[model samples]
Target: MQNVFSEENIKIISQIDNWQKAVEIACQPLLEEKKITQKYVTNIIKSVKKYGPYMVLTDYFALMHAKPGEGVNQLAMSLLVVKEPIDLEGKKVKIFLILACPDSKSHIKTLKEVAGVLMDQCNFELILKGTKSQIIDLFQKKEMDGGKK
Candidate 1:
């Protein structure tokens, strides 16, 4: 809900040629802000090649990331909704949730909240169909609800 993504870190790409490009585009906000180095994106692609896209957490969703300290400048996150799905072997990824965590302990809470959003079909659908501003507002709503009294 509350993350780097909440503050102009969201991207709505029409399509990408490959998953690697998807990762790169998703990391753009973090890269622009210097929250992560180019090496971070490289490392993440390498990890996916060697280990596979375990990040494809569920239907129409994928969570992209590198290990903590692998070019991380801070604990921040970015989200990219690719209008055209990314094919990972056979899995299709429409949402790319990228996170740059300063260290191991800093990412869990944010990751959990993000995973929650992805797990809900309605929420995920909203992301797929929403405009850039609507997408931002969707997460903002989640953030506000997260802090309920």
Candidate 2:
């Protein structure tokens, strides 16, 4: 789906180095799309950070096994888990594509229908045997394509 957050929000989220920042960045697009309110987004982020992926599983039945534990790893896992269909300002939001560190192939099967699923092994092998920048550049290109890539 097309990203709803403003470019400034996307930039702010992307520039930050922390997982919290990443979560904020991920949610910004949904907030702007009106698929979720700011309050809901904040709550989702907080819940995921504290309780893990279980936060959205009830709302999104497909996320039955999305619970991650604590800390940055959990936070990253939470972001990777919370995928739901949403309506943004009238448009129906379809997917939430996550790009992780390649080797962390924890939930590839769960995201079969969304879009790209980069397994850590596949990504790591490519980076070591091929070019690391290609993956990063792909993400950049996707972002530039407004999430359609």
Candidate 3:
């Protein structure tokens, strides 16, 4: 199994003033890689504002994204975590997994791998405190382990 995460696709932000900025910051890696544009980030925030905090995956985690095919150049992702939680309306989020994809189907495998980690508290905690390389290594190790329990 191969890891989708790398040093270039991850960020650990110390703080953010708002959820909109958080989504923008989380998508920065994708932006830098030319995988997505600023418009994609704006659409994501717009969707969240219209729909509410339905994307918050867990207590402190969120999956930030918009519908594919908007400004996505390819399937790519980034991880963003903050030192403290920020308000997304009523919910608080400190971790973000932002994704941009070439098509609707391309990111399923990626989401599956991410969901595997999200299901394991131990793994998620490691992600919370881990450095960029440590975070990438965790995903690689999990992939090599075949996501074993």
Candidate 4:
């Protein structure tokens, strides 16, 4: 099977210790693939760097619901969702960071659905805490599960 996580991509991913780095690295491959332009990537990176990831998600939902900004909002909305990290494990792991918010309750059902989708596609895990070692362990365990299956 082709390795979905290329060395360059891994380098970029590893460098993502903050939201700015995450935006830049996450959008780099897309820019290279011509899936998005440099200007768009810059905009996204700036937005994340300024307001953070949760703000981006909030903007996305606002645009989706209100169709604000003559569709620029909608475009931003789609970009945020599409920019979610690809499943390099060949499986889906819907890791949600729980926060104190009223809407957080709604996310549980959707996150569960995402986990189910991931597992159906391949052996996967749903993590709440975003620890690197724990994420690695999930993939390692999935590999063992695959062997058994």
Candidate 5:
């Protein structure tokens, strides 16, 4: 499989002022790469407002996304690791995964791959504290290991 993440697609930040800011920052890499439009970012915030932190998939983690064509240019993913946890509604989140897919079907495999990797508690903790390269390496290793630990 191709690499789902690149150096340009990841970021490590110490903190964010709020969940909204966190979302924006998390989407920055994809935004800069033209994988998604500003409208995509706005749509995500709007969705969260309407749905109430539904993207916070689990404690300390979030997978922020909007429907395909809200402004997507391609299928891509971005990562933002906040060294200091930020609040999303009542939940605290440290990792944000911003996904932009041109169509509904394209993201399914990548989503499963990511979820499979993070499903391991050990992988989740390492990713939460990992450097950009470390995170990329972990993901690649997991993929090579057939998504095993």
Candidate 6:
């Protein structure tokens, strides 16, 4: 099986100009890997524009995703850690988690795994300041632990 949590899927950037740019940057890896089509990115942005920053799950994190089959090609997830926070309307978000799951079932597992990590303040801080390898390891560890602590 191809590794879902590879270094290529994680990015650490100094900053982003805007929330839309941040979403594009976060989904770039997945787009290049053909995990999702450009439409998926557009859909997420449009959804946010229409519904506001509902994806901003936490003060520092935003989980960007559209419904399944919008353009998802596979079950994949990517992360973008920005050194400086991007303003999503009024919310400040530095961590962008882009998800491209082909179906409902796969996203649940992915969401659970991500929630496990973010639920812990220590892990969340580590990811905010972590190297790409460190972030990859954190996700791998989460998956290995079956989304447990």
C-alpha RMSD for every candidate? 1.8, 14.2, 1.5, 12.4, 1.3, 1.8
Best-matching candidate per TM-score: 5
Clashing pairs in 2: 102-120, 103-120
Q: Model 2, residue 123: displacement in angstroms?
A: 5.3
Which residue pairs clash in candidate 1?
Answer: none
| Residue lDDT tens for model 6, 1-149 | 13457888889999879989988988999999898999999999998989998899888899889888879999888889999999997899999999888988877756776777888999999989989988888878877776677
- Tens digit of per-residue lDDT, candidate 1, span 40-139: 9999898888888788888888878878898999888888899998897578999888878888897788778776766677777889988888777766
Candidate 3 yields a Cα-based lDDT of 0.84
lDDT of 4 by residue, 11-37 (tens): 212222334343445445544544345
- Model 3 TM-score is 0.92
In the range 38-144, model 2's lDDT, one tens digit per residue, is 45445545655566544232221212122232211221221222223443223222222322212345435334312342333453233223332454454445457
- Poorest stretch of ten by lDDT in candidate 6: 1-10
- Report lDDT per candidate: 0.81, 0.34, 0.84, 0.31, 0.88, 0.86
| Residue 59 miss distance in model 1 (angstroms) | 1.1
Clashing pairs in 5: none
**Which residue pairs show backbone clashes in model 4?**
none
lDDT at 134, model 1: 79
Say which prediction, candidate 2 or candidate 3, comes out ahead on lDDT: 3
**Between candidates 2 and 5, which one is better according to lDDT?**
5
Sorting all predicted structures by TM-score, with the top scorer first, yields: 5, 6, 3, 1, 2, 4
lDDT of 3 at 124: 84
Model 4 C-alpha RMSD to native: 12.4
Better of 2 and 6 by lDDT: 6
